[model samples]
Target: MLLDHGERILTASEAIFRGTGTKLSGKVAGIHWHYGTRSHAPELTAGYYNTRFRDGYLPIASMFARHGVIFNFTCIEMKDWEQPGDAQCSPEKLIKQVILATRKAGVPLAGENALPRFDQDAHNQIIRNANLRLPEDSGNTTVEPMCAFTYLRMSQHLFHPENWRLFVSFVRKLAQGQATSNSWEQEHRDTDKFVHAGGPMVQEAAALLH
Candidate 1:
């Protein structure tokens, strides 16, 4: 969400293009921050993880937020940490980093997605700081089974637009009372079957949605 002087504002793709996490533009604010699930993922530079986060990532997030652009971030921890550097920071810490950076820039958190869920306190803090509501805990248990499969895809292939589309749609269905335990189980089995057979799992999932 975008805001001016604490009041809501409508921002379209054109205005949001600057915040889409690709490039930096003087005319736009906000930064797109993406991270892989593994520790020490090589998508960014090597051997300077802390520096990159503090000097590069946080600064960019801060700068964009100062100008009323929300710095969107996506981080997931789905597996064991592959490096000590990755283990040094908890998911909560990372979330705090982003929250702090954006707050410093005087804007609300643009958006954040953390797969497999974080600790309850982290969730609460996010909700509090971002002024967002959360799904009821009782409602969450029904969808817990799907978290692993979802985390698998997000960890391995979330950067792909098609995969993200399928994942988001499936999650939405779960949230909207359109999904059931049996259906999610079927979807998971179908995904596994298709992926194992080297088929396009996302497209297959889309067909399942219909």
Candidate 2:
């Protein structure tokens, strides 16, 4: 039923895009689907996950691909299960499965963080997922990097001195496509000039947080 509803929406969207004859026609990027591990029953096991993929997500991915749509997912920072008992229902496992499905379907895959986290560990996990560094993706030449990534939320907490510092480092590493050994002090120094020069823009961003 969910798949049918989604197909109907996509069909309508396709008609609007192809028939509009406007400059923005056919410019839709794709659709986003949020998959949460907690949404599954606790009793579900690894076999259930496999079946869900084979019967559920894989077909959905293929359908989206047929409509020339990208499949973007969330909670990418949940790299693995924290509890050994919950390993069977790990979000990372599902993420990897979806990645392979999108690849097979010939659709672009993108992701976003599930929660707001400014720590290095979370940043590293997101980077790894974005780059498809998992064992499943290893040695696969056809595996493509994520088309994009989005930070989950914006709040005053994100502008705190420490969080802002970490964010700057995170963005720098992502932009450069590699890690850096730069300390927080160094990042602060580098961003000082930009902050000073773009005071108005910075103020505007702060205003949005309020």
Candidate 3:
């Protein structure tokens, strides 16, 4: 846990991007930090194993939050991580919880993801069972999973034209030069993945963003 002014303001894994094991914004002002998720395919960088939305989505979002971008957001993690589910209903309960949490905090929130179920331990075993090639995204590209500091994604109850437009413009700026390769460089150097952003969620938000 991270503290500021003697107050517990940040959780460990959620502090950074969850799956990517990224660091977070160092703030404890009780302000709402924003984040995003479920936009692109996993990056298979050296040592960097990019898990799908559920595994590292929250951590990635936290990275965005720390950068003074978006603060309030959520992603759904389903019960079975192996079987891919619809991003919309993957983590139904988690979506609701994040919405409630953000509202109680009185902050703006965005939901960018699909709902999917997954079990970490079971999935790990399955990786070997299925003989799936493990892609690492930490040092030199592979960042291990950091479960403690993950941010969750939520669903949209209503659509706001103005907000969508603003978000679209924002993501377009971030996505300007981002791609799987750029993300690979950042991960390999142990730099910052949040700096390099863009995905389906950003694109969709842009289309809706006025």
Query: Number of the top candidate by TM-score?
Result: 2
Q: Which 10 successive residues of model 1 have the least lDDT summed?
A: 142-151
* lDDT of the structure predicted as candidate 1: 0.39
Per-residue lDDT tens digits of candidate 3, residues 1-210? 121321233444354556674534331111111112343232222111223343333343344345433343323222234334443323333343333333333333433223321223322222221121222212333221111222122123112433333333333322332212345454333322322243455456546645
Return the TM-score for each candidate structure: 0.33, 0.73, 0.21
- Give per-residue CA lDDT, model 2, range 1-210, as digits (tens): 556776897787777887555321111211112234443433133112234333346666777787777787877777544425523436676677777777777878778887788787888887777777556555777667877778877787877766766776677677665566788677678766655565566567878878
lDDT of each: 0.39, 0.64, 0.31
- Who wins the lDDT comparison? 2
Comparing 1 with 2 on TM-score, the higher-scoring candidate is 2
Per-model clash counts, in order, read 2, 0, 55
TM-score of 1: 0.33
Query: What residue runs in model 2 are displaced by over 4 Å at the alpha carbon?
Result: 19-55, 81-89, 134-138, 181-200
